[model samples]
Target: MHATPLTFIGASVSWGKLRSAVTTWQPLGVVSTISVRAPFLNTIRLSSSIHHTEETDVAAIDLDEANLILDILHRFQEELGAISDAGDRLKQSRSPEVDEYRRRLVNVKGELKNAAKSGTLDGVKRPQTELERCFYGPAVQHAAAHFRLRTDAPPSMWLSGLYDPAGDVSYYTHGLRKLVDEGQII
Candidate 1:
């Protein structure tokens, strides 16, 4: 059995994607074909048959898209802060912030949906998943805490549920802030 070692040239490959591709390897034929792209190196696709190559659309987030996502995250912080303003109010109507929170949620969902529908998601790639989880994890915790507070549950019930979403917002924004601070994003 002869193995055709693949060589990547003119571009770099993401290790995570490379690892996943190699793990699912199958010997389709004696001669294996590999596709490599330049610039925004995404992944490597291994196949036994010849494959067509296409120009890769750059996976980048525009300033407007980045700001919209950041705005939603910032609103999450405001909602958490006002949870106590109407201590007696139900979670559904506790504060106007909740309504605004829901609105922002819908707004983001819409933006993503529209982007996908237009085949433009490649152009608006959101931040990396790890960074996204930073915001999402805390948001979930804060929501749980808010629910517990509304239900009059004992503090111990959600002792570990108090997470500040702004931590992630600031963490992510810090990088962007630096870029702008240095006149990089003007």
Candidate 2:
């Protein structure tokens, strides 16, 4: 039996030979280990352990082991003509038409902001009405019909779309870049 040693603060440790050492390791919560072997690559092996309380789960994954298993699996799947990859999944989830609509909404918002800055009531009203008609009206109606989300959903909910992984990655990347630029990250 291969033993993976784990330690807990305040837990008694009799650090010595395995034969003589006493292990008082008790389940802090539900404890489980999952071992995975890749069929395509006999060299690939992975073991993941998860410990959890009623509230939270703590996972311990060896990056090297996990990577080896994933690489093998990916290659096997590719060879076996497995289903679509991540990019395909992303494309399937995001409709180009929906993205176009979102882009138009963003343009409408910009127009509305410009109108407001002009400080003329008529200038604001026309663009505001156009925005409501062209963007929010159809969006709200669609959400209500399909997802049953309220027409009056919060601004944040309206601003955010169904699935935009690229957008999320871009947002995070921009934040990281900003941090680097400000010398907050090294």
Candidate 3:
């Protein structure tokens, strides 16, 4: 499958420090923006013509897949939040060893938020590294498994197997093979 690219725009923080007779505090507001582009012309596709052939089953499968994707996205978001929280705590503690970790975490968190704002997490952007791609493979495979297909089955096979013969048989199969050959898939 073709993957889209994501571009980060900018980030901003709002709010000012408040000082009282004996204490000072600041509440920060961070806003990040990004743009998500799809490699495919269409973001979503449905086989309407064949719906009548197996409407109920197909609809159920689609719903299950959608829910699975949503769960994965939620988990990803939670992971990012945990990373950000950990960084914030480390920064507050002022620990020497955590200094480097904090910086890296903050940077990664920012990038992730920017990507999310840009809708990249919606499956628009293809992962830049094989590791990242593999990280998300389980989620894809979960959806496929719900459809009673092999975990390594091409995504198109689980989605619209008959309609996109070329995609299911050639592009996806070849892509998987290439990934395996290059050690991108394990």
For 1-186, candidate 1 gives per-residue lDDT tens digits of: 432332212222222231212222233333443331111223333233221223332222233333333444455444433433322243445456555544443433332233233221122233322223333333333343333222233223222322333343345455555554565431
- RMSD in Å for candidate 1, one decimal? 14.5
TM match of model 1 to true structure: 0.31
Q: If scored against the real structure, what TM-score would every candidate get?
A: 0.31, 0.20, 0.25
Scored by TM-score, the top model is 1
- For residues 56-175, write the lDDT of model 2, one tens digit per residue: 222222233222322332333242221112223334345464454344334323322332342221222222222223222233233223332222332234333322322322333344
Q: List the candidate 1 regions with Cα displacement exceeding 4 Å.
A: 1-58, 84-161, 180-186
Candidate 3 per-residue lDDT, tens place, 65-163, comes to 232233333433343344334444543454564555444444433333333332322334434322223323443333222223232333223233212
Ten consecutive residues with minimal summed lDDT in candidate 2? 13-22
Q: Which residue pairs in candidate 3 collide?
A: none
Candidate 1, residue 45: lDDT: 38
Model 2: runs farther than 4 Å from truth? 1-33, 41-43, 56-69, 81-186
Question: Which of the two, 1 or 3, has more TM-score?
Answer: 1
Residue 1 of model 2, lDDT score:
44
